[model samples]
Target: MSETAMNAARMIDMLPDSDQHLAYELIKKLVLAWDPDFTKLTPEEAKLLNEAENDEFVDAEDIDWSQIGA
Candidate 1:
């Protein structure tokens, strides 16, 4: 990350936990405004997502949903 971005993150980290969400929302808006089509993921995010894609799991159709509300 760029020095300015790192600095911004450090500043955000110093905020109280209750205010951190506000900081996050502001950053998200700015990022979206700068690139509305943004969909790129970080290398670590991509790696984790790729691993999840290959994980074994049950199919949705096989789930016993009737037991959920009971």
Candidate 2:
């Protein structure tokens, strides 16, 4: 991430929970303005996706969904 973006994120983290939504909305608007398609992934999301790629694959037929929360 750029230094400016890191600073912006730090400032947002300092805001109260209620005000965080405002910050998020502002950033979201800016992102949409730049890329109307909304095809971009935030750095954090990309990191999570990279991590998930290294995880073991699970087969749908090998598991039962009903047993998940039982």
Candidate 3:
């Protein structure tokens, strides 16, 4: 890892639990905004990509567990 990344990780680690969570969320937003990969896609590909992203519809607590131990 780069020194800059290491420094950032250290700073993140020093945050209190709630602040750490907020920092993580801020980082996620930054990463999404920093990439332009989606902008280069053809229109049709973009539509399909968006549909697949939307298709990941599971909620954390709503998962089916009927076959978990089978």
Q: Top lDDT: which candidate number?
A: 2
lDDT of 2: 0.91
Query: Mind sharing the TM-score for model 2?
Result: 0.53
Quote each prediction's TM-score: 0.52, 0.53, 0.49
Residues 1-70 of candidate 2: C-alpha lDDT, one tens digit per residue: 8899899999999999989999999999999899899777888889999999989989899999989989
Higher-ranked by TM-score: 1 or 3: 1
Model 3 earns a TM-score of: 0.49
Report the Cα RMSD per candidate.
Answer: 6.6, 6.1, 11.7
Report the CA-based lDDT of candidate 3 relative to the real structure. Answer: 0.82
Greater TM-score among 1 and 2 belongs to 2
* Clash list (residue pairs), candidate 2: none
All models: lDDT? 0.88, 0.91, 0.82
Which candidate model has the greater lDDT, 1 or 3?
A: 1
Summing lDDT over every window of 10 consecutive residues in candidate 3, give the lowest-scoring window: 35-44
Error of 1 at 27 (Å): 0.6
Alpha-carbon deviation at 38 in model 2, angstroms: 3.5
User: Candidate 1 — which pairs collide?
Assistant: none
Q: Residue 41 in candidate 3 has what lDDT?
A: 62
